[model samples]
Target: MFAEHLSAFLTHPVTATVLLVIGIVGITLELLFFSSGLLAAAGVVGFALYFLGFYLAGFVGFGDLAVFGIGIVLLILELVVPSFGILSVLGAICLFGGVLMAAADPKQAGIMLGIALLVAIIAVAVAVKYFRHRGVWNRFILKEQLTTDKGFTASPDRAFLVGMQGTSITPLRPAGTAEIQGERVDVVTDGGFIPAGRTIVVVMVEGTRVVVREIFEQNS
Candidate 1:
């Protein structure tokens, strides 16, 4: 009698709705807050409970459960490994397929899937807008800039090279090396190509960028 009642309860639409709500809330919180994996753990537990309910109600088989687990694993891998979005796409497909296959009713499954997708979208938007620089995403993106204040320099200051004359060591198809004051300096032409061995004058120096213009001689 107890077993029958339990099965009925697990299979009930109201119970399914409750489980869906719990799962969605758990996942949203997981994404929105950096809780040192506590929120993520709760989300995993909520999803596990959802699958367990379906399994006990005979709505999902072992194969469907395995697929769902694989999907979750792939999603986790997407966070750590950079597959250029292939893992994320595959994970979404697996998750959707598993959920749809586990449903006893197609209409109910569609509704539930749509709700879950909407919730996920909203949660992601909130996280991106408000918590962009604070969460797990920081691990994948570079948020620091190496500046002079940080004791980082791309090249030594070439400000003194401005207005200095030089000879092009190689054809400046916009950029090439030049011998200025006996020092080989990398330089770029002013939107014009200069042939090798041509006399050029440094017109501008901005940080590592040394701009030069070809010099033309006039017969007296």
Candidate 2:
């Protein structure tokens, strides 16, 4: 009796399409926008109603609902934790499988899935472009510029060290310490090994990186 009532209500093409659109939009907004989980909650409710309607219409069963719920949970986890795309992929697979299984016609399912995917992609692109500029997004993004004008310097200016002669104080298997101009400085060789006490010439000094070469090799 319940199934017959649900079928009557959902039998209208317009009604079913509206429900599907609502579900897709809600989920897309939840995933793309950070709304303190409010959007997520609304999305969950929308999807639950969608699945319930299908279940009552006899198009889907409890098994399909379970799969869909698991998929939603996985997606939520993807947002909460960094899974390196693993959880998101699994969630998408479970969601698609559940939707396919509940759909009576394969052609309709394919069309609906395609539409959902397209909408999701557009939503993500828009969010990435505009959302980061918003004030709320600033709380999550690092917007500070570390520059000399801001009194922020990663290392002292070593431009004067360029062209200076030095001796390797430690073996430089690409990187080691060197004594240059009566001061100890960290240095790196240009793909060459230099033993301790070997004479070296500072070839380049860029910020904190002091690049050097063997003095003997330069003459030879």
Candidate 3:
């Protein structure tokens, strides 16, 4: 009797929406901090509870779980490997599809996801504004700029690199070095490998990340 009530409550629209928000916010925090495993664990627990509740109610299936798992793998790969956002898009689709599959109806799924996403976005914005210094991105980047005498020169804005042609200094199996505008810059391919000494072009530049693509000649 208690279990039945619990399941019903968990599957309720309000409860499910709250769980989704918690899961999204928790995971976002984990990514932003990348510190102790606590945040990640908490996010996982939120998702687990939500899924378990649905499962207990017989609303979820193995296929849905598989799709969700694939989405997770793709998202992880997107973080570890740069595919120019392709993996991110596909992963998001799969994740949403999985959740929708488990939802009681399409309208309910849309409303829940929309609300959860909006709340999560606001929460993340607040967290970023207030906790900028504690972000994990700080760990990977060098904040200090050294003088020229130190033999390390700070790079100027790279926005101009777009549309510039260059040569690959090393084989880019997605990420490698390239010589652009007489400067050796670290670059990543859209999603393919370009051998060393190949002609390449800067396709896009986001902050310090320079994306390049191989140039192929067409035979007349």
- Give the whole-model CA lDDT for all candidates, comma-separated: 0.76, 0.75, 0.83
Q: What's the TM-score of every candidate structure?
A: 0.61, 0.60, 0.60
Question: Candidate 3's residue-wise lDDT over 1-220, tens digit each?
Answer: 8777888988888888888888778766866776465765676676667777788888889998888788777866865785766886797788778878877676888898899889989998999899989986677688767878878877677989999999999999989999998999999999999999999999999888999999998899
lDDT of 1 by residue, 15-129 (tens): 6555555555555555445565676566667566666667776788888888878877886776568587688678767766776777788688778768766766676677678
Return the top candidate by TM-score: 1
The alpha-carbon root-mean-square deviation between model 2 and the true structure, to one decimal in Å, is 6.0
- Give all candidate RMSDs, comma-separated: 5.4, 6.0, 15.7
TM-score of candidate 3 on Cα atoms, chains taken together:
0.60
By lDDT, the candidates rank as: 3, 1, 2
Candidate 2 per-residue lDDT, tens place, 53-92, comes to 6677678977887888788889889788847668877886
Once model 1 is optimally superposed onto the true structure by TM-score, how far is the C-alpha of residue 128 displaced, in angstroms?
3.0
On the 0 to 100 scale, the lDDT of residue 57 in model 3 is 84
